[model samples]
Target: MTRELARRDGLFGPIRVLERKHDGARLYCINGSLQTLMLADGVSAFGYVHAAKILVAEAPNVLIIGGAGGSLATMLATRGHSVTVIDIDPAAEQIARDFFNLPPQVRWVTADPLHFITAQEGVFDAVIVDACDSSGIVSPFDKPGVIADLLMKACPRGSLVVNIVAEDGAPPWGGWLAAKLASLGLSVCLFRSEEGWEGNEILHVRVDGPTDRLAITDLEQRPPEARTYLMSLRPHVASHVPVPATSDNGAS
Candidate 1:
C-alpha cells in the first residue's frame, strides 16, 4: 500500500511526497515524473538519477543543481562529502526538509544554479546536474552553455555527473550534449540503467590525461541498481545512439 505524505504547489506543479509499503521508500514526485527517494539518512535509491552518485568518489565538496527531495545531497553528505544543493523553489526545499529529512549540514541555497555559481567562493570536486521540473529538463540546464559553466566551475581534478532520460527510439540528447561535454576537455562515459525497458543514463565525466581519481571499475562497491548500470558500460558509451529508423520501402 502507498500513501501520499504531503503535496506542495511547486513552481512546476504539484510536488508530492509519498510513502510506499513495498520498498518503504519516501517517493518525491514532481510534474508527473518520479524525481527521487529518501530511503535512509544519506542513503537513497529508487530513483535512477538519485542513485547516480555511485559513480562519483573522493568528492568532498559536491554540488547538486536540483533539490526536489535532497536525495543526492543526503547520500553525498552521508558519505562524508560536504554537499550544497541549489534550487529556485522555496517550497521544494521545505518539503525536502520536512518530509525527506534533508541533512542539517547541507547548504540549501534558494537560487538559480546559473547565478548561484557566479557568487561561489570555491569550486566543487563534483557537480551533479540533475536539474529538472515537472515538464522535463529545466532552464539553464536545458541550455548547453549552462552545463559548460558547471564544468568551468569545477576543480581541475574534478568530475561532473549528469542525469539524462533515455528512451527506446529517441536520442538522449541528439549526441550533441555529449559532444558539447567533450569539448570541455573531459572524457565522458555513461551508465545505462536499463531494466527491461529503456532507463535513464548517468554521464560520468572526468578530465582527461592524469588524475588521482579511481576508474569506473570502482563502481563495483555501489548498490545493485548502480552496479547494474556500471556493468552495462562494457567498453564505453560515446554518445546517445538512437535506434535506427524504419522505412516504408517494400522489400522483395
Candidate 2:
C-alpha cells in the first residue's frame, strides 16, 4: 500500500513524493521516473546507491551531478564525506528537503551540470553523474565529450561513477561509455544486480585506481544493513570494446 504525500509541477514535469505504507519508504518521482527512494530514517533504499557508495568510500570529497531526492548526497554526508549535489531544478532541492528529509549539511547547487563543470574551480575526490529526466539522461551528460570534459576539469585524478538505467539486462550506452572512458586511460568497472538488470547499472571509472576489485573501506562504521548490501555487490572491469547499443529504456 502507498499514499501520495505531495505532488507539484516541476521544471522537468510532474514531481511527486509517495510513501509506502508497509516499509515507510518514501519515493521521489520526476517526470514519471522513480528518481530516489529513502527509508524512514533517511537512509538510501536503493541497492545501486549503496553499491556506488562502496566504490567511492575512500574518497573524502564527492560531487553528485544530480540531486533527485538527495539520497546519495545524504548517505555520503552522513558517512563524513563532504558532498555537493548540483541539479538544474531548484524544486528538486526543495522537495528533497521538504519530503525526502535531505540533511542541511549537503551543499546544494542549482545549475546546469555542464555549465557548473566548466566553471568549477575546486576538485572533488569523486564525481558521480546520475543526471536524468523524463526521457533519459539529461542533455550533455548523454554525450561522451561532456563527460570527458568533466573528468579533465573537476576530477583529473579522482573517480567518476555514472548511474545508467538498463532494459532487458543491458544498458543502452553502458558498454560504449565504458569503452570510451577506458580509451582515455581510465580503469573502468561495471556493477549490476546478480539477479540481472533489475535496477540501475553503475559504472565506476578511475584515473589511478585498481580495476580488479572493489574494496569497502571503514566497514566497521557501516550499519548492519549497509554492510550487508555493500558486501553483496559484485563489480567487474568493463570491456574496452564497445557492445552494440540496445534500444533505449524510456526512463525509470
Candidate 3:
C-alpha cells in the first residue's frame, strides 16, 4: 500500500510525495510524472538512474540539468563523484531533502538549466539532462540546435546522458536528438526497454571518443538489488535499428 506524505503546487503543477509501506520507497511526482524514486536508505529505485550511473562510472564530476528529487545526484555523490544538480524550482531542493532524503553533500543550484549551462564556467565529466515538466521535455531542449549548443558547452569532451519519457504513444524525442548529435560528430547510442512500451528512453552521447559500445562490466559489480534494472537497458545505434536477439549492447 502507498500513502501520501505531502502535496503542493510547484512551478509546473502539483507536486507530490508518496511512500510505499511494504518497501519504504518514496516516490516524487511532478505534474503527474514519476520524476524520482528513492529507497528507504536514499538509494535510487529507478532503472534509468542505474543505467546513467553505469554510463558515467568513470566520471569524477557530474552535472544534472533537472533536480526533481535529486536521485541521480544522490547516487553519483554516494559513489564519490562531485555532483551538481540544477533546477528552476527553488522548492525542489527542500522537498527532495525533506521527503526524498537528498543529502547536503550534493550541490543544488536554482536557475533555469539553459541559463546555467550557457553561463557556468566549470566543466563536468558527465552531463545528464532529465529536464521536463507536465507537457514533456521543456523548451530549448525540445529544439535540437539549442540543446546541442548547451551540451557542447557543458561537457565538451565527456559523456552525456539524456532521459526522455514517452506518454500516450507520443514520439520519442531522444531518437531525433540522437541523430542530431550524431550528425555533429558525436557517437550516440539510444537505450530502451524491450519488455515494455511506456518508459524512459535514454540517449548516451560521447562528444569525443572512439565508437566503441558502452561497457557494462561495472554494472555487474553493483549491488544485486540493482541488477534487474541495470539489465533491462538495451542499446540501439539509432532509433531505426532492430532489437537484437541478444541484449549484448552493453550498459545503457
Backbone clashes in each candidate structure, one number apiece? 1, 0, 0
Q: Per-residue lDDT tens digits of candidate 1, residues 165-194?
A: 655544455244555566555676655544
Superposed model 1: Cα runs more than 4 Å off: 40-42, 47-51, 133-136, 168-171, 194-198, 210-227, 234-252
TM-score of each: 0.79, 0.85, 0.86
In candidate 1, the residue pairs with backbone N, CA or C atoms under 3 Å apart (3 or more residues apart, or in different chains) clash, namely 31-134
lDDT of 2 by residue, 12-41 (tens): 789999999998989998777788878888
TM-score for candidate 3, residues paired by index: 0.86
By TM-score, highest first, what's the ranking? 3, 2, 1
Which digits, one per residue and each the tens of the lDDT, describe model 3 over residues 1-252?
A: 899999988887899999999988889997777888788777776677777887888889999988988888888888899999998987799998888777789989999887777788888888988876443466656655665676578887888788777555545566666766676767788887664333677788776674235566776555455666566667777544232222222211
- Candidate with the larger lDDT of 1 and 2: 2
